[model samples]
Target: MTNFSGEVAALAAACLWAVASIVYGKLGARIPPLQLNLIKGIIAIAFFVFTILVTGELFPSITILPMCLILLSGVIGISLGDTAFFTTINTLGPRRALLMQTLTSPISAILGLIFLQEKLNTLAGCGILLTILGVAWVVSERTTDIGHISTAEFRRGIVFGLLTAAAGAVGAVLSRSAIANTQISPLWAALLRLSAGILILLVWASFRQQSTFRLSSLRNSKVIAGTLFAAFCGTYLGIWLQQTAIKFTSVGIASTLLQTSPIFVIPFAIWMGEKVSIRAILGVVISIAGIALLFYL
Candidate 1:
C-alpha cells in the first residue's frame, strides 16, 4: 500500500488540477497571464505558510545543495513553465496548449533515465507510451471554435508550449532529486518551491513595472473567488501532492501519472454540457488501460 502512495497522490493531484484548469480558463480572459500567474502564486504561498505554521513543521533542515535544487525547480517549473503555459493557452487555445504538455512525461522519463538513472521496465514503458498517446489524442481533437492566429503568433506559441513541457520535465526531475535525497517533508518542499517561484514572479513583475497585486481585479467577487479556489486546488494542494509523488516514486512514473489531468477533464466537460466525441472516449479508455498497467503490474 505504501509503495503505491505516490501513484495515488499523482492521480489525486491530476483531479485537483483538472478542476483548477476550468476555473483558470474562465479567469484568464479577465487577467493578464503574468498577473494571473503571480496572483495565484501569492495566494497559494499564503496557504503554504499557513499550513506550515499550523503543522508546526517550521523549516526542515535541508542541505544547501538540495535546497538550491528545489528552488531552481520552482523557478523553472512554476515561474517559467506556468507562465509559458498561460501564454500558450492565450495564443493557441487550451486544447493545443494542453497537447504540448503531453510531451512532459516522455521528457521526464528520458531525463530520469539519464540524470537519476531511473529506468522503467518494459511494462511501465508501455504504460507511459500508451498514456501519452491517449492524452495527445484527446487534446488534439478538433473543436468548432478554434481561434485564428497569425503564423508568427502560432510559431511563438509553439515555442512557448515546448518550453513549458521542457521546463516541467526538468523541474520534476530536479524536485525528485532533492526530495529523494533529503528528509524534507513534502509540505516543506512545496513551500520552498512556491516561495522561490513567487520571488521570481515578483521580481519580473517589478522589472516590467506591472503591479503585482491588482486591487481592481479583486473588486469583482467572481474573480476573487475563482482565483482563491483555483490557487488552493491547483497551486497549494496540487503541488503538495506532486512533491509527494516525486518523493515516493520514480520521476518517470510520477510524471506520467501527473499528465493524466487532461483525461480527468472529460467528465467535467460532460457535466458542463460540452459534447465529447467517440474519439475522446476512446482516448480515455486507452489512458485508463495504461494507468491500470502502471498500478497492477
Candidate 2:
C-alpha cells in the first residue's frame, strides 16, 4: 500500500502544475522567461529554506558525486530545457510547442532503460503509451486564430521544443540516479538542483548580455500575488513532489505520471469557462483509464 505513495504524489504534483500554468501563462506575457525563471527559483528556494529551518532536520551531508550529478541535472533540465520551452512557446505557439513537448515521456523511458536499466511491466508500458497518445490528441486541438509565423521560426521552434524534451528526460534520469545513490531528502535535492539551475541561467544570461532583472512587475500587487502563488504551487511544492516521485519509483514511470499535467488541466479549463471540446473530454477519459491501468493492473 505504501509503495504507491510515490505515484499518488506524482499525480498530485501534476495537478498543482496544471493550476500553476494558468497563472504562469499570464505572467509569461508580462515577464521575460529568464527573469521569470530566476524569480520563481528564488522564491521556491526561500520556501525550501524556511521549511528546512522549521522542520529542524539536520542538514543532510552531501556527497560530491550526487552533488555533481544533481547540479548537472539542474543545468541541463531546468536552465536549458525551460529556456528552450519558453522560446518554443513564443515562436511556435503553445499548441505546437506542447505537441513536441509530449516527446518527453518516451525519451525518458528510453533513457531510463539505457542508463538505469529500468524496465516497465507490460501493463505499465501500455498505460504510458495510451496516456501519451491521449495528451497528444488534446494538445493538438488548437484554436483557429493563430497569427502568422515564418517557416524559419517554425523550424527553430521545433528544434527548441525537441531539445527541451530531451533535456528534461536526461535531467530526470540524472536526478533519479543521484537520489538512488544518495541519502539526501527530496526537499534538499530539489533545492540543490533548482539553485544550480538558476545560477547557471544567471551566468548564461550575463554572458549573452541578455540579462534584464525586471523588478517593476513585482510592484504590481496582482503580479506579486500571482508570482508568489505560482511559485509555491509549481516550483516549490511541485519539484519537491517530483523528487519524491523519482526517489520512490522508476524514472520512466515518474516521468509518465508527471506528463499527465495536461489531463489535469482539463478541469481547470472548464472552471475558467473555456469551452471544452468533446474530443478533449474523450481524451481525458482515455488518460484517466490509462492512469488506472498503471496502478490497478
Candidate 3:
C-alpha cells in the first residue's frame, strides 16, 4: 500500500457511512435508537465472523492488549456513540446532526496529544476551527428560524449530536492509541470490536428486559434490514477501513476525512428532493477545505 493509502480507506469508510446514514434516518422513524443500536451490533458481529474466516487470522492468537482496545472502542464508539447519533439524526435530521461530527477530528487530535503524546500544530488548530465553523454555518442557518417544532426539540437534537461527537472523538483517540501499538491485525481488531459491541448491547438489553429472544426482528423488516445493512457497511467495513487508516496515518487526518461523510450526505439529500439550501453545500465545502488545511499543516 502507498503511504497515504489509509486515507483512501478512510474516505471509503466515510462514503459507506454516508449511505448508512440514510438507512438509519428511515429506520429511526419507527424503532428506538437503543434498539436499533443493539440490532446493528448483532449484524456487525455476524459480518465479523465472516471477515475472520476470509482474513485467515487465528482467532486464538489475539492478545489481551488488542482485545482490550477493541472492546473499549466497541463500547465507547459503537454502543454509546452511535446510540446518541441515531437519536440526533431522528430529532435533528442527518444533515444537521452530522455537522457536529466535523468536530471529531480536532477533538481526537487534542485527545491524542493529551493521552498519546501526539504532536499538535497551529495550522491543524486553525483548520479545526474553520471546519467546524463551515459545518455549523450550513446546519445552523435555520436554527434560529426553523418552526417545525419547539425550541426544546432542536436543543435536544443538537445536544445529543454533540454528545455523540464527543464520545466518538474519544473512541477515535482510543483506536489511535491501540493502532499505534502495531501488534494486532486490523481485521482482528475489527472483529473484536463488533463482538464486544454485541456483548455490551445484549448485556444492556437483558438488564433492561428488552430481549430479542422473544421478539422477532423479522416483524420489523425495514428497521431490521436498514440496521443490518448499516452494520455490515458502516460498522464492519467502515471500522475495518478506519482501523487500517489509523494504523497508516496520523489519526487527525484520518478522522478529518472519515467524518466528511456529511458532504456525501448533502448530495444524497438533494437527490432525494429534500429541499436543501445552498448554505448546506457551502458548509460541506468549508469543512472539506478545513480537512485539507489540517493535512497541509
Q: What TM-scores do the predictions have?
A: 0.85, 0.82, 0.88
By lDDT, the candidates rank as 1, 3, 2
Candidate 1 wrong stretches, greater than 4 Å = 1-3, 92-96, 112-140, 147-156, 209-214, 283-297
Where does candidate 2 clash, by residue pair?
none
Output the worst ten-in-a-row residue range by lDDT, candidate 3. 209-218
Candidate 1 C-alpha lDDT tens digits along 1-297 = 257999899999988988888788778788888898999998999998888788887678889999999999999999999999888877765545665676776666667778779767788678768866876676555554343566677678778888898998888778887899789999999989998988998889888855655668778999999999999999999999999998888755776678777678778877877777888778766765665564345
Pairs with steric clashes in candidate 1? none
Q: What digit string (tens of lDDT, one per residue) describes model 3 on residues 1-297?
A: 457788899899988888888888887877788888877777777787876788777864556675687689878887888889999888878777777777776676667688779776898878878887986787666643244867788788878887888888887766676767667777877777667766787777778755434345447776566677888888888888988888777755776778789888878887877877777788888887886777668
Clash pairs, model 3 backbone: none
Better of 2 and 3 by TM-score: 3
The sequence of per-residue lDDT tens digits that candidate 2 reaches over residues 1-297 is 357978887988988877776677678777877777778888999999999899987767978888899999999989888778777667654434444555666676666677779776898678667756765676556543233665676567668878988998788778887888678999889988999999998887787765477778778999999989989998999999999988887654676677677667767667876676788777766665565555445
What is the C-alpha local distance difference test score of each model? 0.80, 0.76, 0.77
Best TM-score among the predictions, by candidate number: 3
